[model samples]
Target: MAGVRKGGDLEEVEIDLGDASDPEDLDEGEQPETLWKASSDREGESIHSSSLVDISDTKPLINVRDPRGMNDCLKVTFEDVIAEPVSVRSGDRVWIWSHALFEVSRIWVYRIVTVLLAIPMSILSGILFAVLSCIHIWMISPCIKCILIGTRWLQKLWDVVLEVIVRPLLTSAGRCCGGFNIHLAEE
Candidate 1:
């Protein structure tokens, strides 16, 4: 069972590949039967078989060329992007050929552009990141550390000045004014 999305709607397609595992069960020169049945989700629609491709050979139906899965951006093909609902299908071979041309041109253009730009852009990015890292680690970080150490020393000096000079002066002033009293008499 495979789900194919056509124009933002997912339509279910049932694929019948009879007896894939036991090839010896069939007699010589007998090929496995492959059936593609379209089961649409729309109401009152009948199931129909469309021969999309011949997959009688032992090769995989979908060949993934990207072994490392790097080029995920290029995974969108003609079938993925272009599709017609059952009602609006034009049944024109020219449209199909145009679609094939569009897909091939898109893929080739992207590959060529990437081949031209990927290496240079990657090198530039690597150099930029390396420079930024060096500036942060060697220059900015050490400067900040030095400023913090100087700030700690200045804080200790400020605390000592407050305790020694300010506190003594305030205490002496308070002691001198301690005995002063005012009395009011009315005749």
Candidate 2:
């Protein structure tokens, strides 16, 4: 799925090329060979104006010979940022990326949200932990265990909020990323 921001909406466009092994399949032996079509043409119309030489056989798409529109962009990939999380056991690597997610962030807004949310959540969670600990020591094992279980739900809610709220704002206002933010210069 590719994320595209068109007309003020950040959309996830799925280009499911089940097997793009051959471009020939796309051309009914007669794919439109125009550089661009008439702007006035109705949607889905094959006819277009302006033509470019047939270099389709050489490459599936054209290189960015022009960067008239692209400015201030970042890219992210799965293997680089989240994969190979630090090991839990010393000298033992655990490839536990079962829930790995990447996100693009604007420096200012993301930092502000982090500061606002982190301090309160951390303090509240710490207090909850301490209270739960005391409860457990007082033989209230089930109640303490319940709060421990609730933590996982809170984690999931945080994940959803980040995706639904944070990602959209950042992509539209901060970066040109759909889900993940721009990649750093150094891994």
Which candidate number would show the highest TM-score if scored against the true structure? 1
CA deviation > 4 Å runs, candidate 2? 1-104, 141-187
Error of 1 at 166 (Å): 28
What value does the lDDT take at residue 101 in candidate 2?
Answer: 22
Model 2 C-alpha lDDT per residue in residues 144-178, reported as the tens digit of each score: 77787979889899999999999988779755444
Task: List pairs with backbone clashes in candidate 2.
Answer: 37-48, 103-180, 103-181, 104-180, 104-181
Clashes of each: 0, 5
| Candidate 1 global CA lDDT score | 0.75
Candidate 1 local lDDT, 25-67, one digit each (tens): 7689886554445657465354443444545553443564566
Model 1, stretches more than 4 Å misplaced? 1-74, 147-187
